[model samples]
Target chain A: MNPFAQKKIFLEALQALRLKKKPKETATKTDASVCPSCKESFSKNALEKSLFVCPDCGHHFSISAQTRLDMLLDAKSVRFLNRRLQGGNPLNFPSYEAKLAALRSETGIYEAVVTAVGKIGGVKVVVCVLDSRFLMGSMGTAVGEKITRAVEYATHARLPIIIFSASGGARMQEGILSLFQMAKTAAALERHADAGLLYISFLTHPTTGGVTASFASLGDVILAEPRALIGFAGPRVIEQTIRQTLPDGFQRSEYLLEHGFVDAIIPRGEMREAISRLLALHGRTTA
Target chain B: MTTPKPRTAADRVALARNPLRPSVTDYIDHLFTGFFELCGDRRQAEDASILGGLAFYKGTPVTVIGHRKGKTLEENLRMNFGMSSPEGYRKAQRLMRQAEKFKRPIITFIDTPGAYPGIEAEARGQGEAIASCLALMSRLTVPTIAVVTGEGGSGGALALGVADRIFMLENAVFSVLSPEGFATILWKDASRSQEAAEIMRLTAQDLLTLGVIDGIIHEPPNGAHEEPASVYLALDAVLTRELSVLCAQSGDALRKSRYKKLRAIGNRKEAL
Candidate 1:
């Protein structure tokens, strides 16, 4: 069985063991603060059919990279790059590699990101999708290399590039090397920008840190997904440093758009059509 | 008693021989004869801080864009203390695009604290404005050169900095961020600006060593402000020579060389 299923079984057995000795605690009170939609929770299979959203309230949880790719790209158009690229425990931090291995086993993804050359609405472009499941989509050497290679490919082919960023920032295990990716990716985007090719960066929920400071902000037309968090440093860090409370909706996608940091805030459902319109505006077509 | 009389006019004339002040305006007028000053971004208002127009340097037509500071409070306000807004950058871009279209070699003189930081500026998309200028300058098909005449700070300098050759005056500094901002961000105190300045390695000599700048133009003793005329002559000579070399290349070669030149920056390190 997969690790996720095995872990679920282990948790169930532990709960059953607790239940066996709970005869005297049968009248125990339970918290009444559960999500209203989750109160009548459906089976996991049923949730999968609804895109992992809450059945009643339709609260959209995060989706996997594969699901996002399937929904975004043209049918059978994704040609994945760098499947063999994986992370390393360079810092020798305790249990880093073990944790990564367990995550790999559970998610079946090699890295935090997947890069591909695909067609979105018949427009040939390079697309990089960040998977939040793997280490919260932290950017490491592999992620950086994949992005740099994608930009290089787009520059060589004279094609537009599109990247959907959903990162928690640079990977800590990689140390300063992860920080260097900021400059590396910026330089790549510099070359691509110099080529007069369009680069559209789509910022998703929780985009922050070194990524926001680099190529993510270097887009010719920067678009953010609804309610995405985009900033160089977290509000808590800034507030702690400055010793002041932040304003409402600080660093949210709508706030950034209003503040002119992003060009527009696009909803996930309409992203493909919006991207197609932008590509068409640029007179770019599929190969 | 006879020698105690007031000195003659000759003594006063000899005393006035301070090397600091010279015939700077006269020399610049002669060297850059037929200079025409252009104004406005054509989209909105004009910025006095950045001056750009056609100028004849040694009988050759060249486009000159440089930051110009004022000597008085009113003029300083007019010039915005040399901190340009989006209009200023757009004006520079307009001249650059025109120069490229006309196949004329371009020379830009950079001297700005940074881009203007104001709520109105942000409302008009300052980052996007700078990004647009960078994009436009990078793709221009003309031979372009940038001379850091003074402070070269962040995106303000970078907007007009994409060129085949970058020359900086000896005392000038070019950096990603101002020393004060660097200090505040890295040290958590603005008082460490001097320390931040030292660590940033912003001097022209340092940048030359890092391959960030192509060459450094020697300034007169004390600085450019001391001998403005002699400095202008020296700058005019260097600008003429660089422009001549760049102008010798074809349009396609110029574009290719500029692209390669920009691509070659910041490629020195390996993973540590």
Candidate 2:
């Protein structure tokens, strides 16, 4: 073929590929009932009923920390801990205080992780859930202190500890103090483990960075919600660093399970029962 | 690479990141002997970015840990440009624990832009690893010395920096964040790093004035790269003097001194 003709053919193929990729994205945007993953449409009521998991493809949707607490804990059994503490900007980074205040007002939460003593399947446990909605669940001083205290509390009460993790890693606004939490929380977890207490960590959608590396990975029985993204570096950054395409379903819950990083991949609906079973298996009595 | 006079913090930062600068291996080769490298975090893969092992500093057994930035582009890629992951910090922790068990002193070299910021790093708990290192170092029974050879950036630097004594090369820069990061976060433009560098007080002199570093090892006018032998000698003399003084103290006394030293920092002027 002539050079111009060859160039024209390549351009047309590129255009065709671009055209093929747009519809799924536009479809999700156009219809509120459609899921971005699997490109399947469902009624709003159906999605709400399924706990936002795609009925067809098992795509787990992100839920608020409160929703997770409600889903896992027994009816009206949660007693919040460390509710009065707030993060102070020790580094005095600009806009951090205001951003935190805005997030506080918007999320109605003082910090990212919520620690509570709650009942799961009538079993008493200290529960902590990280809300990704607040500051992408980036850990700071308050989050670290809250988690450490919760673990210590669990250790003291001789109760099983369960934490649901979803985070973007450490908060940059807090500087070194933000990174310090990673150590503090892990150290507390170590002390908790030393007391022979059972700790279960649930890796939710998009658990990455410092949160994944610490207490989340330190769980005696690590569980992940189906299709949740879990890794240290994000896929994009990894791709850029290595200059290669990652394998299919890389860093997903299934992939982690295969690599021995995760024990099981349970669906959102199964989480309550699965956790209950694990707690019971660990000899925690459920009355 | 020939370094300029480095009057400004940005200039010092450039010198710190210069490819020709003398690194951890160079110091180990010149100042220590019978160096045997130990690898792995025991829980994961060995991290090449952190060079850690047992070595003899002037016939005194010590655990040496330092960030390793590669000299070549290919090496840099392999070493992640000395930006450690959780594994690196864990490996350091393992070595520190070993040092504690053997009653050996610990010496660390700080020379990295920062810890690796990737999803995998986060997922593996980068913050937790660094944090554990800080806690471990703070409570360690052995005498510890940290040398800021170049860019001691962020918590990654502080992870290895909790010690009885901390020294910085005259041209080194240490801070809570990089100049570019500070500029981007504060001014909304990374190009304003020169301005940010001025305001952050991250240079060796600034750190000394602010009581962040115990002392400054004066580098040659052309920098450590151009005068490796002299730089090695200066570092050796200080290490010997400090180690001798530190070794004389009892373990409990050493721990108390370290705690006091760390706590006393950032409170110098306020107390005055």
Candidate 3:
């Protein structure tokens, strides 16, 4: 067997051995937990088929970047732009390099994002998917560079651009350099806009901090995934500083839509169709 | 006349002796004659932060684009604290293009803290939005004038600030980054914002001397926020005078002048 396959088999056998040793502990009675919004009990197989959404309640849980890419684009259609781009330990922050290595292994993706230039329902687009599993998809140099290059490609090709954002905020490890990415990305987007190309933004779960204040909010049509937390600062920090209770659904996608921050709120299942329709409406199609 | 006391907590307490500033609506009503507010970018939903429309300044037709910060909580939320998203800049670009096509002079009132910072904003290409505005303004044929009415922060301010004549209110400040942000980045403590502010050279007078601004439109003795009507009248006079000079130039001349004006900023001659 190949090394990867050998490793996988070894891991599976080790897990089986552990399970055998802890059979009594693993066989403990399970407590039923249902999604409060959807009133659907969690099932591993059902959730897998349903994109981790509650089948009964339709509550969309956070999804990984790869899963999102697979769900949005045509089967095997994604052509990622810069797969080789990687982050370095710029600040030499203790354990930062090791953390990145760990994240890379866990997520099976380089950097915080993977940008693809591909067709979604025959419409040409530059799509960037932020992997929340990797340091919460922070905007580091690699992430920012990938985004800038994607915009440049879209602008040059006169194709519409769409980016799915799911980030905790700017990477704290890179510090001021990470903050500079905001201006850099903004400058690039400005060039795309001048080219008269359409750019759409899809904000996903738990988007906050510096990312919220810069390029993420600059879409021609700003759409938020259902229940995504979109804001400059998290509610906990804001409340702690303000010394007051926040309103219900503060920074939630629905609240933002009502408050005019988001152009639309789209469910996970319908997002691809919605984006395709928008692309068609804008005449941004290759086929 | 003796200069007003330096802005401080004590000064602010003393200034409380005066009344609060006039609302943006009130200022516009008093200054703009035959004003008509335009809505939407015609491609997307209307952005409340960027207020664009046609207005008459002393009987001369001019297009007005202003960053508006509302007063109450509802209004503030609506205006997004005068921080525009991509659509806001797009709306301004639309208006500016229309103004150029119609041969009308363009006047912009800048007060935004910065462009809106959010994931949706980035995903939508906020950087492209601001850059597009800058590129469009750079090559615009019509006479363009920008007045810094309040806080002019970062690329948001620059999006509407590429003009033949850029004016600043006495109390207004313009900088590449906010003082608090610079302080936090440079000193690792946001509380040193006052020191950062002084070092940033962002005051209207400082910018005027640096040639980043064309002229300083004197605000009320207290500030524009205190007596907006007086500030607006002063702005009206300066804009009228600047517009006449800008209107006389041809398209090529306008583009060249603007290019020169921008290129001149931050250029220092070496001493041999």
Candidate 4:
């Protein structure tokens, strides 16, 4: 740290993440974490025991892609896919390369989304889990290519696929090419769907922008975690355009269920059971 | 392909957003015949922003759809200045399916700021609507073409842009979002739009090289708005040539080719 690295500047850096929820003031000295939705704090071990779900208010804290993989996949049944495909300074956007590199070492992942083939409930499936830690899980060229290749693989392998999306939208640093990723991913999913393969789109917190408007919304059965912000555009953009404060719980998973956009709101604990059950049912023949 | 007079990104952006520029309504009048405008998603409401229906393109039955731009404030309000709601996209999807069922060619003229970002739009499932359109268009067996007549904005424009062939007019601009929005979202300064526009590489020439678009249709020296008839003629020539080739393919062949073309966007040979 610089000799003059003050508390204020450190705090500002934490808040500058552009995340839907700011980190809960990381200056704490205790071995406890606070829930952003509810004002309750608990020991880190307690939070992990509940899978980071707030025991009091039931708020689902975001989890890392690795944490999610460990929770969903069976023991030693995971093989990563498309790790060679990662982001570049495609448009030469200033500081983009530096930011991506910083994120790489910080998150220990090559890109925002991690694609792999793994077993869920002992049933093999191709899975994609978008970690918002890197660029808010934005879909740029590499993220798009990885997903397209994932869907293509599932189509070829006759495997059901599930994608847990946690994104802000298109990666603006990559410019128009980021927006085109929407079409690219959807086009690949079209081939997958045509083969009569099952696709379950699992939207996590803060899935908006290009991601929501693409493959996330195209899933035959779309599922979301409780209270995840899933929509085409962000709430701030919508509020600014509408000139009105959104009603309570607007654009939330519950709201989407009320509006029929999502099939169900499955909690983090139930996700594995729900997804694996769907995959099993989909594989069944007429009886 | 570079021409003698290269337009700065800013210049192309300005020309594309010019109010006097030709709109989808004008193009339909000039090129299509026996036009019958379709309305309503048959779900709840009719979105005035996107207008689509049956038409004859040079005596060939086709389904035409596009974002509607208006000349007056009231008209623009009626059309929501071409920013679609979920219903607009649903209407487009309905039309695309109709075209596919009947085996008629589909042509879409894209020009919009984007899907309307408002409370009502979200309430109606805007993302699902656009995603459904892309899914349906990607697999459509009929010949399809999408032209960026003016502004091709984000998912709203892309909802209709998953085509077998996509072209952009010389002055038209297509990007993830408006330069102003980009600057605002990234830097919290909308005035940096010109700088953002430059980096966006949204012009037809840039997109062609990037393989984001298939071709470009040249406009007159003054601009397409100044010489609407010439713009129409040029587009007519391009569409006629392209459609003849696309129409020759079998349904299975067309489906495969469209899938391959769209899948190639981020799969650039210089992939990371």
Candidate 5:
């Protein structure tokens, strides 16, 4: 077995040992959660307190955009931007409209990205966070427009910008129009940079594809959640293309930091504090 | 003298993918002198799909980059059938940055089906790599030109195509995605790709009319493959002329104009 696969088995066994003592930690407690990576179980409330990071193995679970906003921003602090912007089926892709409708109701997300003006550690900032639950947070025209507008908003306000990227890539259903967002968002960010404003990119679990290609990698300071997978392409494709087995822990945040792709691997628990410290250092303060 | 038979969008696609067509190497050999290839992205293994190098165009030193499509099956496999990986775009970015630093005029040839669509490519951040290239190319201070020599398919083509001036060969096709993909998605019939090709506004003439491309280079009676030497000569003259005109401008001017050009793409005013 692959080294990573073997490690996963060992972790499962260890977790089984812990579970043996607790007869109540059964499937009936489905509302509670288990870390797929470390196989450690926790009550949903406990996991929320931990910010969804697995305490034992440091695995970062995919958090919804709403949850992320709640964790990162102050109480009742968010003023959403471009909430009404949505993508039309430009290519008239069959079933795309229906799929969008289904996804909208299912995810409670209008689009893949949520752009908002919010307070983080009492510092005002514009944020565009990607919700992976919404079609894997694919970058469509609407998502791109939202990000660009948010960056523009930050530039105009002279406030800092923070973006949390979690995407599979350009929306396949949107066709080339979707791919073009990479350029659109990047161009907007370039103008934002011209204003000499600060932009922070927070990479969560599975930040890949066009999102990683553009604004995510263009941050003044880039940070990744602990053990988050951050890369342009996944390991399986790489392995298949090159016809070779990949090294253990490939494309993980720790591996990326070692390779100088990211500034640091920040655990979820310390993320708020870290952002606060960064904003303070940048001399950006709330009114 | 018979006029060149009118070609459909699907026919043009076939022409673009024709095995006998002149590849990037042919263009380099016929256009530039003292060509020296620079490989590896430095972050990962070298990607063979994108061929980037330094060469002297006419009497001036320049940087040349283009997709490398192979005519033979073995060579095509080696070059991933001209489909680039994340490392491929990164390698292009590395060279482009170098070009910007040295003030060398950058010329790129666009001819790819798209970036490789595979699990590993996505894992590696293929979209990010391509997006960075678009962002980087847009802001590069040096003069930049891109030629759509064949199939300018999706983000893969756009990666090298965010230039100050974009020109397409008479038979080349540039679209957001492959017609087959477009057809499959829109019509639920992949065989209706020909219909998608027509509706996509992807042919050189359509793109030029739409102002998506700056200009189009006229090919021979059949296509570029029918007369490679003449096609290369025509491209050479146009490149030299454009390079000289662009090179006369300040780097800041080039950067500003490039940014404006990219921003105006989907804008109502420009699209109108």
Candidate 6:
């Protein structure tokens, strides 16, 4: 079976485990998520305490952008930027707008990325975090513009920037115009780099394609979450192109770090601390 | 000439990929003089897929780089059928730096399906190389122009195409991915590419309308392959006029205007 197909079964099994672990008192369906790795079930409150990392097996369950913001920034210090920006159906692809609307109401997010600026270890930084549940965190026009604007905000603000990327790639519904977003975001980053500002890219599970080939790779320091799949092409695409089943653990974060593409593989529990420590070292640039 | 009728997106796709279509090698002898070929990324082996060198266009020195897709099967394998690898982009980056250092205008011809998707490419940082090229191309101080001669597939094409002025031939197509890939990914049906192509808005005219390109260079009826001379003449005139106009601007002005062009794409509404 394909790795992803196997993952589907594990996901179903994990859901069943979540139900079983729910306590009789105040045990709601939304109150627990089971780890697919260790098959260990934990209450949502417990998972929040662990920063969504499974304490038993150390598997990182992907977190939402809101959770990420709260984890990275100080409580009540989070100030969102460009939350009103959304994408129209430029290509007029059938049902794309309707799909976006459905995802919006379901996810309670305006777009795939949440651009914000807040204190991390008491030092302000701009961030654009992608949540995969919403359209697999694709880089559509809105996502690109938000990231570009955030980077631009950082350049002028002289603040550090961080992006937690977990995208499937560029959105297909927007067609060719979706591709231009790559160029747009990268240009903003180029200008930011020209200004000698610090930009950190944190790659999460299954970041690939346009996202991988653009800003995610342009970071001055590129970091990935443990076991995250990071590459330009998806593993299935690679296997189909080469007509071979990939070796175990191919395209994982360990493979990338070993190849020198990633600076380090950071686990979820330590991500905020790691980012803040790096920020402390770089400091704020005067120029 | 027959009355020009609109071509279907799939028709343009086939026409752009027509093996008989004129490649970069066909245009060089017709457009430039004293072409001296440069090689290597300086960090690794030289990439044949990306052909970069110094040349004199209309007696003015300039840097010329292109994704060289070979015509024949054996030649295609030799050039990886214009599917550039990490080294190919690095090679382009080196050439771009050289062009900036010497104050020469940078012109690139894009005609790649996309970056080479293979295990080795993944191991060597294909994403990093393509990203580096995109970032560097955006900031180059010299006047930079890119023309899509054929397939401008995804980041591989965009890596070479971030320029002050971008254009495409009448029949060329540029997109986020091939329609086949799109269909397969979206609908799990590769055979529906013709349907996918219809909505992709990848044709040159579509790109021009969307403001993804500055303009479209007209090709001869029945495609540029049938009669190459007219296409060359038209492209030559466009380049000569654009190169002269861009070259006259100061470095700061060129950089500012180019940055504006990059920022302006997909910004037609506040919604995006």
User: What DockQ do the predictions score, one after another?
Assistant: 0.07, 0.16, 0.09, 0.67, 0.30, 0.72
**Superposed Cα deviation of residue A143, candidate 5 (Å):** 1.6
Q: Report lDDT per candidate.
A: 0.68, 0.78, 0.71, 0.87, 0.80, 0.87
- Residues A1-287, candidate 4, lDDT per residue (tens digit)? 23123323322322332233334443334588989988899876556556678879999999988778766776678999987568666677888888988999998899999999999768899999999999899999999989999999999999998999999989898877888889889988988888999999998999998999999998999999999998998988888888889999999999999999999999876777788789888976867
Query: Ranking by DockQ, best first?
Result: 6, 4, 5, 2, 3, 1
Q: What's the number of clashes in each of the models?
A: 0, 17, 24, 0, 16, 0
Rank by lDDT (best first) = 6, 4, 5, 2, 3, 1
Better of 1 and 3 by lDDT: 3
What is the DockQ of the complex in model 6? 0.72
CA lDDT for candidate 6: 0.87
Q: How close is candidate 4 to the true structure, as a TM-score?
A: 0.93
TM-score of chain B of 4: 0.96
Candidate with top DockQ is 6
TM-scores for all candidates: the values are 0.65, 0.75, 0.53, 0.93, 0.78, 0.93
By descending TM-score, how would the candidates be arranged? Answer: 6, 4, 5, 2, 1, 3
Docking level of model 5: acceptable
TM-score, B chain alone, candidates in order:
0.86, 0.96, 0.90, 0.96, 0.96, 0.97
Candidate 4's C-alpha runs over 4 A off are A1-30, A285-287, B1-6, B269-271
Model 1 per-residue lDDT tens digits across residues B24-117:
2333365577888888999878988788888777787878787765556897689876777778877988898888877777877777766675
CA error at residue B259 for candidate 3, angstroms = 14
**Cα RMSDs of all predictions?**
11.7, 11.6, 10.1, 7.0, 7.7, 6.1
Per-residue CA lDDT of model 2 for B101-187, tens digit only, reads 999999999998878876567557675577568767767889999999999887678778878898999899887678886676556
Residue pairs in collision within model 6 = none
State the DockQ, from 0 to 1, for candidate 4.
Answer: 0.67
Q: Residues B103-165, candidate 5, lDDT per residue (tens digit)?
A: 899999988988896656655667568878888887889999999998888878989988899
